[model samples]
Every structure is written in C-alpha cells, then in structure tokens.
Target: MISAPHKSSGKTLVSLGVMYNLVQEGFSVNSFKKGPDYIDPMWHRLVTGSQCRNLDPFLMGAGNCLDSFISNSDEKSFSLIEGNHGLHDGMDVDGADSSAGLAELLETPVVLVVDSQKMNRGAAAIVKGMQSMPPKACIKGVILNRLQGARQEEKQRSAIERFCGVPVLGAIPKDDALAITERQLGLTTIDETADAETIIRNVGEKIASCCDLQAIRSLFSQAPPLKTSQVKAERKAIASVSIGVFMDPAFCFYYPENLEALAKNGAELVFINALEDASLPDVDGLYLGGGFPESFLRELSGNRSLLRDVREAARSGIPLYAECGGLIYLCSAAHYEGETYPLANVFPFEMGFQNKPVGHGYLDMKSVCDSPWFAKGERIRAHEFHYSKPFDSSEIDAYQFEVLRGFGVTGKRDGVLRGNLFASFAHLHAVANPGWARRFVALASDYKVKGRCAV
Candidate 1:
C-alpha cells in the first residue's frame, strides 16, 4: 500500500506513475483507493484501463473493507492500494479509520511517500514517528518526493533509511510542470484533463526510471490474504424493472456497490449521460448521482432537451433520487463564476457556488419530514462533499432531513422534496445502506405499477 506523511505528498501521482509503468511492461494491475474519493480512482482507471475500486475503512468496516478489496481485485493481477491523507489521520483522535488501521487490518506493508521539498533529515523523523505510532504502522519502505538534485536525493534517502530503518524505494525530483492541476477540490478528474494520457505516460516513465518495482512487489507480497465471504445473489420480485441512472463526465460519482445493490434487488441498470442524451429512456425511475456539475454548467445548460425532460419527469411525479451535484442539476439555476446557468429547474431553489466547501465529511441525519424514500424520524448515516449552497434559504425550509452530525444544505438540514423527487447533498453508499437499493427499486416498481402520485 502507498501512503504519505500528509496530503499532497505525491501519493496519487506516484501511484499512478508506477501503475502506468507496470502496465507498459504488460502487467495486469488492479488499483484501490483508501478513502471515499471518486476522482482519484478515475485517474487510476485511465492508467490501468480497468475499474479502480474504493476500499474505505470508515464507510465500510475493516472486515467488509477487506472483503471488498478481495472481491474487486483480480487474483492474478498486481494490486496497488493508495491511501488518502496521512497514514494516521482518521475521523477522530483514536485513528479508528486511519490508513494505518486499514493496512494493519490487511497486514499490508506501507510505503510512506515523504515530500522532501525544503527539508531532508526532518523527513526521516516523520517516517520514524509514523513507524512507532499507535495502531503500530508497518512502514516497510519510503519514497522521497520533490527532491532537488542527486546530492539532495542521496542526503534525504540516506537519512531516512539510516534513521527510520526503512529503505527509500524512489526519489521524484521537483518539477512543477509534472504536477497535476488542482482547485478547491483535488486534481481535476481524468476525463477533464485534456492531456491526461500524455501526463500519465511521462510520469510513468520517470517513476519507472527512479523506483525499484521489484522491491515494491516484494512488499505487496508480504500482505496477509483476506478471507472473503461467499454470499449468494438473491432474486427479487421486481425483475423486469429498469432503473435509469444519470452518468457522464458531469455526474458520475457512484459507488459500484450501489449499482450492484440495485441489480441484486432485480433492477436493470441503464446509464444516461445528461451532457449528451436529450431524454431519459422508458425506465421505471431515475437515479442521478453527485459529481462535478459546476465544472460543466455551460454544457449542461446548453442541453435544453434533457433539462426539459427531467423537469417533465418531476412534474409527472416520477420516482427520482439525486445527491449533491445531482441536487445542483435539479435546482432552478446554478450560480458559479459570477454567472447563472439554467439547469433542470425542477425545484424552486437556486444553488450558489462557494469558493470553499460548505460541507465535507461524514453525516448523521434524521428525516424531518416525509419524503419518497425515508420516513419521518428515520435515522441516516451518509457523507457530504459540496462547495455550493442553496441560494434561497427561506424556500429550503421545506426540505426533509435534519443533520444530526456534519453540515448539510442549510447547516443543519438537507434533502429537497418535490412530488416523488428526493434531492440531497448527503451521498449514501448502498453497501453501508443495503436498504437504500431495495427502497429505491421498490419506489421505481411502485411507480411502474401505481405511479408515484401518492408519494
């Protein structure tokens, strides 16, 4: 597993570089990300030409996390798990959801990527401290990043290996041109990057020339294998129901398990790209997930047919579900970059863009009003990541959920309801909420039979 002393320490870049380089050498690689990230995995997928799965220790417990890792990763392929943030940073001071905790759970050796910019011996102290930190991290190696020259690399590498007792597996020199662009969120998604392939190739060649892949492979081999449970697929009553999901470069933040859950509950999944398609198919209902709608507001606004279709669906009382960016799309307009862009306009609210995040963490919520999905007073555990706010606060008071923990649409509340529509900033992972899929499918089936007029 690849980890770092802190965020922006070239963990994703190094992992991508190594992955591309390995693929160049004809190795089938399966990559995994250690947190609730939808973007980084896209870059990994572009590099490896395969789906990159997320193995979040917090969203899924250690046992289920390990099982997920085993389930998604190919046994014959090389597995590369990348950790987000620092190895020890978690939800609380106890470090319960830390990368180190996940690594220890899988018995995976960690290769700490220490950023060597503007420091040398101090890097060793960070590694040494991490090695002895509680949860007892097994720091098997180190990768020195942002080195100046051969002399600096030798000094930093030697100091870390000498003091921390972990070998420096690689050294990436300081090159501003090599770094990926970043905004309030992390790096731009792979599809958004124009020269992503070229960038990955260049970085991969550089990492291949610098890093010892054989040693990295040895460290991967040291991880103890996780035992996965064999649960048979259950057939359901609504086998013919097809659930439409909005998926594209604009809105593609979906958990693989979420789609699988819908499938397991006997719903046929159909993906529609709002940026391209003009209308939803004759499916039972729609599922619009969270993603970077703000980045493609003009294109989304230009898609008038799709906008009209979604609005018509809302007016027809179709059972529809939306989260975060999906919620932004369903609003009257999205105000960003000093301009207003017309979207679905299904609800009576506008979303105002913020330069910084309004909500960014785990959410504990309770249904404050009756919605198509959740009942009143029903508790929910989900996550929120957004940089926009509901522009009309007075209008938003009619929404459903009250935040018990973590911020939401109006600091304490979220989930906008219009007819059978359910829109919220909090994203629910179906793996964590198995009933989410069942309930959503049931709504779609009910819509197909009796229509969602009652909802």
Candidate 2:
C-alpha cells in the first residue's frame, strides 16, 4: 500500500512511475486504488495494461475491499495499491477508518511518501509520527519528494534516514511537468489530454530513477496469492441489443468493466461522438457516461445534428442510461459560463449551476417504480458527485424517480428517471455492483429483440 502524509504529495505519480518501470522491466504487475476514484485508475490502466479496481471501505464493506482486490488479481508478480487522501484521513468522527486502516486491514506494507520541500530535519518528525501512529501499520520505507539539488537531496535523505530510522528509498526532484492537470470534475479525463501517454512515460522514468525499484518489488514477494470464485457463464444468452456509447472527450467517464460486462452479456457497444459527430449511431440503446460536458457545452450544442438524433432516438423509446454530466446534457438546456446551450431534450429539465446544493458521496437507492434499469422495490448502491441541479420543478416532474440516500433537490431521494431514461447524479463503479452491467445488457437485449420483432 502506497500512502502519503497529505493529498498531492506525489503518491499517484510515484505509483504510476514505479508501476511503469516495473512493467518495462518485464514484471507482471497488477494495480489497485484505495478509494472510488475513476480517473487515477485510468492512468494506472494505461501504464500497466491492467484494469485498476477500487477498494473503498466506506462505500463498500470491508468484505468488498478484500473481494475486489482478490477478484482482480491475476498470476502477476506483484500488486500495487495506490492509497487515497492522507494516510490517516477518512470519513469518521475519530478518523478510525482511513487509508492507513485499509493498509492494516489488507496487511499491506505502507511506503510513506514525504514531500520534503520546505523543511530539513523537520521531515523526520512527520515520518516518525506516521511510523509510530499505528504499530500494526507496517511502514516499509520512505520516499522524499520535491528535493532541490544533490546537496539538499543528500541532506534531506540523511536527515530522514538518521532521525526517522527508515531507509530513504527515493528522492524525486521538483518538476512542474510531473504534476497532472485538474478541472472542476477531477483530474482532466485521459481523453482530453493528447499527451497523456507521453506524460505518464516521462513521469515513470523520473520516478524509476529516484526510487529503489528492487526494494519495492521485494514487498510483493510474500504477498498472499489472490483468490476469487470463477465467474459462471449465464445459462441463457441475454438479449442482444445495440448501445450507442458517448466516446468524446467530454463524456468518457465509463468504467471499462461496465462496457465489458455489457458485451459479455450480449450487447453491441456502438461508439458515438457528442462533440463532433453529426448524427447518433443506429442502435437500440444509448449510454452517456459522466465527464465535464459543461466545459464543452458549446461544442456539444453546436453539434445540432447529434442533438436532433438523440432527441429522435429518445422519442422512439430507445433505452437511454445517462449519469451526472450526461444527465445534464439530456435536459432541455445547460447553463454554463454565463451561456445557455440547447441539449437533447430527453427530459424537460433545465440544469443550472449553483454554489449551494452540491450533491456528493455514497448513495443507497431503491426503485420506487418499475424501470428498465431496475425493478420496482429493487435496491441499488451507488455514489453521487455533482454541482448542477434542475432549475425548474415542472421539468423534474416530467421525469419520475426518487433518491434514497444523498442530496437530491426534492428530498433525500431526488433524481429524474422517466420512460426508458435513467438519469441521475450518481457515478457508479461496475465492479462494486456487477448487477449494473447485467441489468444494462438485459435492457439493451430486450429493446433489440422488441425492435427486431416489430421490424
């Protein structure tokens, strides 16, 4: 388990760098993230060529944490877990369940990353505290990040080694290019950055040079082999339906497992461009995953033909599944940066930006009415993180749905799902709830069979 004293302390960069270098050295490495982060894992996947699974104790139970880790592991040589937030920070009154807690639970050794820019010997105190905080939490070594020069690097390295009683595994020089970009959503989605691969590779080399790769690899030597139940094949083929997946830079927040599950269950995945594509791809279903659609609202709205195609598709009763940013695009209009742009009017709602009512966090939802995505009375667990809300109540009335847990406009349960449309502020990770993929494929297949029969 790789951790740091605080956020943006180069844990993610270091993780990627280490993983990349290891892979280049021809070692089979698997990657995992500590929390419900979709973007960071994307980078890890790009570098290691393996899907990075999320392990969040709060959203998922402790059992889920172990299950997800074991399920995704292969016959790889080692598994690297990139932690979230500060080592001892989590969502609890007494901070009982932080990333450090997760490391302890998994019995994974913690490689503490210390950002040693300002202080000299003071860095030792921080590392000493982290090492002593939980005796059970195994802190293997320390990596000094943002070291100035050879002289300063040596000084900081010696100070940490002498005072902290831990070997300084690495010392990374301060480089602005090493930092990843960020937007309102989170780190800029991989689709938006043209040089993402190059950036990741360069960052990897820097990390490889600074850090002790041999020592880090040894940590994984004795890790217990991962075990998981083999996925049983479905007795019957799920209906085969065509699903139009939004693939532009603005709408690329889908979990790979979600799409993979859909295809495995017999759904045809068709790629669509919301920014430049003229018309929607012919399909029985439409899926718009989350991203910063607001940033590209002008380009999206300017693609009038695509909007017209979606509006027509929805009118024809094509099953549509849109989340957060995608939901914003389905509304009558999106108000972003002091301009209102027309959108695919699948629902009558109009989304307006607001400082208040920022919906966020783990959500537990139960279907109040029967829908294609979920049956009536079905309970689903997901998460929500957004800042936009429906501007008009009348528009929300046009759609029918309720939120069970989280900040929805009307009450605790507020999301607009009407007809075959499933629009909500929640962002779901498919691995956490494999049923989401099954249900999505099932819905798409049903539509395909119905369409074929009608034709």
For residues 377-452, write the lDDT of model 1, one tens digit per residue: 8887778888998877687546788898888888888887766788889887777777778888888887799754
Q: Would you list the C-alpha lDDT of every candidate in the order shown?
A: 0.84, 0.78
CA RMSD per model (angstroms):
2.1, 3.4
What are the per-residue Cα lDDT tens digits for candidate 2 across 204-313?
88988878888887877655544445644445445367788998778877766678767776787889888888988779888888877877988998988889888887
Regions more than 4 Å wrong, model 1: 227-239, 452-455
Give the C-alpha lDDT of model 2.
Answer: 0.78
C-alpha positional error of residue 81 in candidate 2 after TM-score superposition, expressed in Å: 1.5
lDDT of 1 at 436: 79
Q: Any runs in candidate 2 off by more than 4 Å, and if so which?
A: 93-97, 132-135, 148-164, 225-239, 355-357, 364-370, 375-379, 398-405, 409-411, 452-455
Per-model TM values vs. the true structure: 0.94, 0.87
Error of 2 at 114 (Å): 1.5
